[model samples]
Target: MSTPGGQWRNRETFVREGDGIVDLLTCKWAREHEYRLTKEVWAFRENRIAVHFAYEWHDEKGRWFRSCGNENWESDENGLMRRRVASINDLPIDIGASLFHWPQGRLPDDHHPGLSVLGL
Candidate 1:
């Protein structure tokens, strides 16, 4: 993934390869309390896709936050993601304000409301 501060060389940007990417996700998942992700929107064309997403989580001190982000992805011929760029912002929320009330796993596609319907 090519986050901010990544540089391009030979048509490829700097990316966190292999274990670096794994470690990054591991650390993020490890730190958050009750993390939940909800995909808000997606647009696709050719070999690229753009996704708008939102997630809710709390810190160790019980402070809650809603993180909203957009991610642009480019895939290789094998359908593997070759590049990803993301932009994110976080907003502090009240302790009991979380909209996601489903169980601690994938949200049910038929029952759950998306971000737009929830006025996120």
Candidate 2:
């Protein structure tokens, strides 16, 4: 059984799962970042693991965002995560805010704040 990582897979699979959002991101950020995880709170059954974790991501410049909240994983017998569901509110820091933060074209930071603007 193949484990499910955050948007990790071949291009075709990603397109199928991602609803053709036109995302240029490769599989670079697929797996869970271990350093962010504060603890594995509990495991109710062999198939279910409850955990508390801090999740963060860096932009192209390597500036990491504030660690976010916990997420849960429910795996099959093979320990492959078949179902991953998490309710993430929002982190306080806006050091790196996604373009979606605004209404498509209303960002105060030059109307677009991303790699293209920074000229990565």
Tens digits of per-residue lDDT for model 2, 1-120: 334333323323433223332242333354322123223364566677666544344555545453534456666667765555554433434545522343422234544444333332
Evaluated at residue 25, the lDDT of candidate 2 is 33
lDDT of 1 by residue, 27-92 (tens): 677767898888854889998888888889888888998988787877767676666677778899
Q: Which consecutive 10 residues in model 2 have the weakest lDDT in total?
A: 31-40
Q: In angstroms, give how far residue 47 of model 2 lies from its true place.
A: 0.9
Each prediction's TM-score against the native?
0.81, 0.41
Candidate number of the best lDDT: 1
